[model samples]
Target: MPRSPWWGRKVARLPERGTLIVSTDLQGNYEDYYALKQIYADEEERGNEPVLLLCGDLVHGPGEYFADPARWPDYLGTFYRDRSVDLVLDYAEWIDHAKTVALLGNHEHAHIGGPIVSKFHGDEAAVLDIRLGDDAPRVHDLFRSFPLIAVAPCGAVFTHGAPRATEPDLASFERIRYDGYARTAINDMYEEGTLGALLWARYAEPEHAQALLEAVHEGEGRHAFVAFGHDVVRSGYEKIGKEQICVSTSFGCEDRNKTYLRLDLGARYTSVDDLREGEEIRKLYPKA
Candidate 1:
């Protein structure tokens, strides 16, 4: 775990020891949120000091307002009401904020001035704030403090989106200002400008990830993968090229197939294949 400022840290360096639990794109899904917590809690109860990394998009989920999502068939929008407001309040008061590391998703950036993320209700970030009422200010402060990406010693970099950057260096990340960027609706692409690309890229080719890895650890994990969430990976996880893996823990994915990373910090993974399914990649509720 690392300390954070009132604004942003831009990047996080994960602990060199202990179990690392990585989840992504929760997006106000109450079911998966609780499942994640339970997974962490179980690890703690087992005397494992598990570090949880939530890779952004924690808010602005489509409630009944957006109608039944076509891709996410298991979404129980009517019954449980997995509203972003509740997620905010629960997250704010959750006993584990100290152990939880969050990434600044583009949706979250909308409130604090990064990009306009509109999904269910136009300007969903603003709508979340208005709905938050008194808690909005406090929650917004917490969101502002979240990092854009986390670098781990296990030969992997965790981020909300593809590992896109202005310069091919880590020091450059500290200079980001988080200004809003334009979305090219013609191609349905959200291009992150000079400030930050931490929450934009929807896809990452092997070469693209190779360039990113070359900048970190002096190419130590050049053959490794960058773990991220942004697109809706059908199996809830997919290997992209040779150096990128997308894991969709929640939001617009199958319940049984949705996955998260339970990585061993002490063990260095050489490639995405080292991340074995049901071993390193665990489903929310796997059936026997």
Candidate 2:
């Protein structure tokens, strides 16, 4: 068995008794933001402090609605002028209270890809430059600073996507570290077709999930779980192998329903909840 990549990392430990809000593929939906805010409020009222783990794709890509040439300018301007500002403000508030960690999704990389930002600058200054202007550097730094992989105190691994092609054995996994910008970092897990499979793959094979579980268990010296959110699971959550779970938290044209996972680290339990506007949050856990 190989050693776990998280070995000897001081920040990898998730605090016992703390709650974790595992969310993914927000795609710049303010409704989802409001739902998260409400969830936080509810937890506070219950005297619990929780950490938010954003699995990635905080921003929606141009492909989402830009396929129409006629609506390109309108959509692009809205994202840069309106959505960008709102995203920053909302994220700021999130970071103000609970500890927040984010992973890079393909959408974030699209920002660096220059197409969206190219609409404004026409040059190569980047989208953050056009959208954020003087504040572009700070925003760029923020995105670039996101870690690719984060380990919870309970040893559960959280990522925007799952590792498939480069799925490391225990030894390789142990050597893994958080490098926001390095090629070897988890960020690159979805770069090439082979590696990017982690970020872009839609389904998880039972064998791969089981391999991950075994690696985490052997390397971390504890029973561990893995969670990812790139692929939208219409069912909300899917159990893979013995202890791996995959969830989709995005709400939009594809998935009209808003959902998120509330993980109770202390109880070693997780529940899926539905968030609907003007309605009470419905817990869809224990599978009816």
- Top candidate, metric TM-score: 1
Tens digits of per-residue lDDT, candidate 2, 152-218, equal 5455666666645344443463343333333233334445542355556656665564555555445
Candidate 2 regions off by >4 Å?
Answer: 1-12, 61-82, 111-129, 153-155, 165-195, 219-223, 241-243, 253-256, 269-288
List model 1 lDDT by residue over 1-288, tens digit each: 122221257768777778899998888887788888899889979978788889988887765644444543454322234567777678766634447778888788777766566677767777788889988888878787887778888898887888654346778766676553434341233354523455778765576677777776565857667899977886779887668889988877766678899998888987888888889988877861
Full-model lDDT for every candidate: 0.74, 0.52
**Model 2 TM-score on a 0 to 1 scale:** 0.65
Report each candidate's C-alpha RMSD, comma-separated, in the order given.
3.4, 8.0
Model 1 global lDDT (CA atoms, 0 to 1): 0.74
As for candidate 2, its clashing pairs are 2-170, 2-171, 4-174, 5-173, 5-174, 13-153, 14-152, 14-153, 189-195, 190-196
Q: After superposition, how far is residue 217 of candidate 1 from its true place, in Å?
A: 2.2
Return the lDDT, model 2, position 96.
Answer: 47
